[model samples]
Target: MASPESRIIELASRIAANTKKLNDYLVANNLPTPSFDVKGPKANLVPKQEIEVQAARAAIIDDTQELRRLVLGPREYLMSYTHNELISQQAITRFGIAHSFPVGSEASFAEIATKTGLPETNVRQVIRHAINKDIFVEPRPGVVAHNAVSRLLAEDKVIHDWVGASTDDLWQSASQTCNALTKYPGSQEPNETGFALANNTKATVYEVFSQFPERARRFGNAMRSFTEGTGFELSHVVDNFPWGDLPQDGVVVDIGGSQGFVCFALAAQFPSLSFIVQDLEPVIRAAEKQPQAIELGTDRIKFMTHDFLTEQLVHGADVYFFRWILHNWSDKYCVRILRNLIPALKQGAKIVINDNVLPKPGVMSKWQEDRLRSMDLTMTELQNSHERELEDWAELFKLADPRFEFQGGELPKSANLWVLVAEWKGE
Candidate 1:
């Protein structure tokens, strides 16, 4: 039999190899690749980046083989549940293994175990493991407590399923111990089901949003924060665009325009243009009650209850606007949604999709790219949709409507999100 150290090294080597193979496959398929840059930019090659990459490679390969062993080899399924076990431990560290009280603070294992209804040994083990990962901390030996990262979960209100949750929150989208490719057993083209499993209802995402009402409200609240911090930059940056070139009054419509936030922002900048906001009934109801929105009166701004998938109600609008919406559906469904808008577009209508388009291969930093891809998986596992790269978006448009041609442009200077403007030119 192999020595223990030899086994460990072998496992790491396998992981590294697996990561590389999958990473290579993804690259070949024109998909996103997780960054494992072991070397920084160097002519002769650097050691640090190489080391990290090697480690990542080893982990991926070993994890994959271990997972295979659990499923296909003689190993019992007991260890197959490791990811789920980690998820449970993670939840305890965030939601309270002992009590829902502050984690990582000066709390004894006995007290925490009693509060959480977990075994004392299990509680101790979870806390100890969490501490090592910095999920929580030990102010002193045996005294564990939550830290700031853990505190994100310690909130009374569940803003998003991820609120106050540990890093395992990422796993809530799917409980699979192995990657989705291995879990679903060969159904791997990337669609809404996978996206939803990874995001919308991920235990962490659920922890953040809770239920539908709360989810909608928190979604708006999150966006509100994003707008406040980045709105000025976007407004100023987008304002420089040729709004004058867009259609006149009755030409542009904002789909899913909750509370007229985007319209309000745009109206302030372009006083001459008319705007229409279409959304769900509840959102429209809420928008009607906002003091400023109600105060704005209802002239050019008309609120209507329309579902984008059912039909395109806003006909002949010179432009259709969808902001941060498409990343929530499968490619097929997204194509369906885009096709639904076809009839509403006249000869020259433009569709502006203001959402984060995953960057082209190697264009973005690995961290950002991985973050987005992880989000894509999260969405697949949760709400059943995902963010797509520019090529994905363009191809989707072409698939849905051959008459429509996509044009990519540099988003306004302050815009963190990218834009893919689809123009319907085949009158």
Candidate 2:
């Protein structure tokens, strides 16, 4: 049997070959070709064609960098320990769907322009650019198509709810880093300065999402697709997590759980356990509209409107489940959020956090670490947050409630993305 490294090498070689073939096709078919010119100190005196070529090359590099950050970095981090079946599901989310269908397969650029009242040329150019990055596939010249991979983006109620929750919308704000620095010099450090510029007054997540509507849906859908098939992997691990040992039975408030996807999954798996999904009002509406989730039974699983940054409405839940929430805020803010839960928790209440923990050097694959680090940066840039280490999290827990100590035991494998658990103590 070929070693995994050998298989990866083969795959990389195949990807390179296919890239060359695609490039050749673009050249032969009169599509836009990649420019070769590289910018240099002496480029100011260069010819117009060379300058344009250099600019084009630079744009390609920037786009490649962003794509790598999103796909190879964060996506790979989630995929490393996630189930094998979710790869295609996540890949399809590269294209934002209007009604859960791949945007490319739904209609032509002309059709989109007509629907959105945008110019046809602009729409076509945008779609073409996205297609080049494999966000959408063009089966025939000027005619895009969809495959099984695109089905994850289709108009499913569950998919819609999931998409609304996990997407980021600060890419454009982050792009203005240089402009912000040049306009107003500040005493704040570089990272802090950037954070202030991106989101000082507007810490409200929903307001930020509203500002970047399209981007919010895009990021949310991408994450939702990523979690679809991997649900089983998490379910398998969480299902046996000593639920019976809990001191009391109260609501499992899925705090910040938009649309109740996690709650529904857990409730179905453990029928005896009741769940309450607490999120923003918009998300609660979306979750309520999720017919499939409703079929699971409203008695066992329900939705509640709650915001983490503000007051948490839940009280005395046996467990508070936070999946991929704290990573979006700075350590200080995370503590504030966690501290807010203290008043609502009963004695021995458990706090289960599901997020990617960065693996140390030589502990896991380099590719996986690289992905986590990139997400660390992305989260930092967009959300003014950092991915916390175990120690950092322990500190947060202590800050939240001195009475509760971290349950020091055998740590979950670093490979598992959703693999961190902490517990509360009674005085």
The 0-to-1 C-alpha lDDT of every candidate, in the order given, reads: 0.61, 0.58
Write model 2 residue lDDT over 1-427, tens digit each, in one string.
Answer: 9774465455555445545654555566565544311111211222223433334433444444444444565667566553323323232333343333343345666665665565767556655654554434556665555432233334354553453332223343444444555654432233443434656542444455577777567556656566554332456436535665654445688888877777776765666778888888988888887885678667788888878877666777788888778887777778788878777767778888777666566474344456678777656555556787777777778877787677632334322455556777763
- Candidate 2: where are CA atoms >4 Å away? 1-205, 229-233, 247-249, 296-298, 408-416
Off by over 4 Å in 1: 1-89, 97-105, 155-170, 176-237, 247-250, 383-386
Could you give me the TM-score of model 1 versus the true structure? 0.65
Q: lDDT for model 2, on a 0 to 1 scale?
A: 0.58
lDDT of 1 by residue, 18-45 (tens): 6676566556656555421211111112
Question: lDDT score of model 1?
Answer: 0.61
Name the 10 consecutive residues with the lowest summed lDDT in model 2. 36-45
TM-score of each: 0.65, 0.57
